[model samples]
Target: MAAKSATKSVEQGRNLRPFYANHTPEQLKEALRRMWLVRRFEEMAEESYIRGLTHGTMHLSIGQEASAVGICLELTDKDYITSTHRGHGHCIGKGAEVKYMFAEFFGKEEGYCRGRGGSMHIADPATGNLGANGIVGGGLPLATGAALAIKKRGSKDVAVCFFGDGANNEGAFHESLNIAAVWKLPVIYVCENNQYGMSVSTERSTAVKDVATRAAAYNMPGVIVDGNSIADVNEAMTAAMERARNGEGPTLIECKTYRTRGHSRSDRNRYRSKEEIESWKGKDPIPAFEDELMALGILTQADVEGVRAGVEKDIQDGFDFATKGTNPEPSSLLRGVYTTGDAA
Candidate 1:
């Protein structure tokens, strides 16, 4: 384990170079396919919301696929992940069945949380997904507790907590990082810094130019990456995961990305400019990965189109299954909230 540090510059100087690991052509192809699927799923879900099919507001992960997929690919079945409100990308990357995720969004009984938890609270314990949290910074402590559990169980499993840059402003964020760092818990804190926490920009709230720099106070590795580049995202994630798996400690990774949509269901997003949005859009993860694959002669225009078609069909099937499923019974509303009669 690394010695604890109390200074910011030390942390910054430690891992100035981004981590990179070679991926086979097959693996790269699969990543591109999954990224495409996630983006399509987000678009379809948004359409459902606009069509009055979904009941609640949504937090889309449309433009931030790389960060979610990159970090999640490094996790194992025993390793846990706590997701954010914008959780679809993470859930997909963690291998949660897309059909069930869409079902949950549509409030079906077959959903991940049986339709009770809805979009924001979809969880699958079988896959080690703790669930997506609705409250800002809510999953920070939950993930920390999960890391503590891993320690008690004497396992090598690490907890990956995904949150936005805005979440760093929350007190729970700081508290959890402090505790995890102090105890040397196996947790990787991924801040998907989409530049904005809702409509509020990070610059408006934080004194630090980069959120990763804050990791110094806790004496952990902090890495910043180009969130739009899936390659860069995966490279950084590999290093952080390796560190945690080795019992070294937690890491704070800031992925600088942007969301193509508004803050929530209703925001018009008058705060941000079109030029900024377009600038980030040019760096979209899917296209970047596609370009790389094509450059390596791995993917052609036809292959890309085929992947898009398959993803569309898969998403449509999910929506169909969800809409056809029945809603939950009123009596079952209180289900899973409390433990039933089974004393130890």
Candidate 2:
């Protein structure tokens, strides 16, 4: 068992260079900027919610930024992705404009979905975002359908489904996997296993130590990576997406991450111990990746502070934009409810 574990470590070390070795210093800087944007955006959003500026329950992807950015860095604007309630990072990583996101959060007219979708339901067809679903495991079947649609159209566009460990227990997961493997659809199942399904711990719930092992039941490649390590996630996604784009069916990628915040604002997180939370905080993805960049000479302390200042300014601008924008007119509320025009 010791020898097997040592070999696995050596293989992981070799493949973890996909992001570090391939990208230019400039590219790394931009990637880091996006990660920072996600982190700051969530922080500000939480502040806004506390101040009662944004209504509705919002789930923050506070600690899982690396998984979102790494997988999305491999995607193009034409590729499709579905998200869960904790979906801000995924949307941001897929090139969503923070201005409109703020508008939606504020329920203003300028928002994505025209203030109807808010954070969880925001969808942008222009960017190939099918939309974020509020239901657990909802995106699984939808993503599979999208992959099938792309295959039928003979398009190279692939679909990615970003789900949580909670959804793994749902029937949709197994059903979707069976169909995707049988049809060889171009969809990637990304499980952001953050250890807890709301208040329930994984140890008391999950059947296996690694969710990736479940992929075997469907005859697809299963991969597990450190969700805190940006490079490792990118490397695994590179291989998985490569197989998908090449018409080799789907791959199940389990990113073993954690949620630093409560499952939602109402959650006190009484279910978890303080020691566990602090240990995960020590492994925070943002600072972890920043350290990696510093070691490679791609970033300095000054650069880090500068990036923070820039992101702060940008986030402030988004908040200002949302606060100043007009609320959705009551008369137009029913405008998009149904289509009255011809179908074809």
Candidate 3:
């Protein structure tokens, strides 16, 4: 009787473990650090834009850090990802250095695109980041193509596509998902539904209550997760990635999140109420994750402070690097415009 009781207790404990228990303590700590980094980086970027230190507009993912970090935590360096306009968090989560990103934003010659592509077009091939697209639904087809290439090459790598909810209504979204499902291609489509596309709320634009329901038309699994919870996002992503890697075609995951900032720097934010913004602020991913880590004994208050301090230093250094870097010259404008080498 005692043996059976002990067995039941162990089973209960196993069932009670958090969704993120599969990850090591080190990985959890690193995730927390990256979340903080994403939050701080966007804050600094907004400051720089306000001070006229950077040109062009940028879409800041100030409140949607967990979705980015959680999804990328399940990916490897060999895996591919296509990003959207609001993709700074995705890039940082995929192992991009802040200094180079700053360089790109500042239009310095040492940037990822040699100062050609600004905030909306940052890409790092070394990290398997194809590029961030300025157009809505632009990355959907690209991710599908990349997944097709991986399938043909017989590689196990999968492609993850990050797009906003606005893209869901686009024709490309349907086409990409249909083809991906038909071919059994290894692609994961993640929709960061921040409730609004520009000034239009999802309620006003979307026909359905939840975007994930559309996945049924393509005959794929559709999932919904709280984008503010890193563990929840990670759990969903882990399952989706596993299915993709196992040659089970695509999965559509809609992360129901919110963006604290306006659509862009120029946005007046007249469409939403201040109360709504404050309510989402109370659900901020960073503080919630920090509390979770502390409860699990993976981190303490001092450790959290240390992480914040280190991230601050990194952001400052990146800003200094960008400010001190050289700008691009006009003479090299047409250098990479046309292909010069043989196709063969």
Which candidate achieves the best lDDT against the true structure? Answer: 3
Candidate 2 pairs with clashing backbones: none
Tens-digit per-residue lDDT, 30-99, candidate 1:
6677888789888888998989889888888888999888787667778899998899898888877788
Best by TM-score: 3
By lDDT, is 1 or 2 better?
2
Q: Write the per-residue lDDT of candidate 3 for residues 1-344, one digit (tens) a residue.
A: 00012222212333435444566656777788899988998999999999999878999998899999999887777889999999999998988888889999999987887788888999998878998999999999999999999999999888999999999999999999999999999999999999999999999999998999999999999999999999888888878888898999999999999999999988998999999999999999999999988876667899999999999999999989988989877877786777784221
Give Cα-based local distance difference scores for all models: 0.83, 0.87, 0.89
Please give each candidate's TM-score. 0.91, 0.93, 0.94
Go through the candidates in order and give the C-alpha RMSD of each one to the true structure. 6.8, 5.9, 5.5
Candidate 1: Cα lDDT at 67:
89
Model 2: per-residue Cα lDDT over 43-74, one tens digit each: 99999999988888999888899999988877
Candidate 3 residue spans exceeding 4 A from truth: 1-18, 341-344
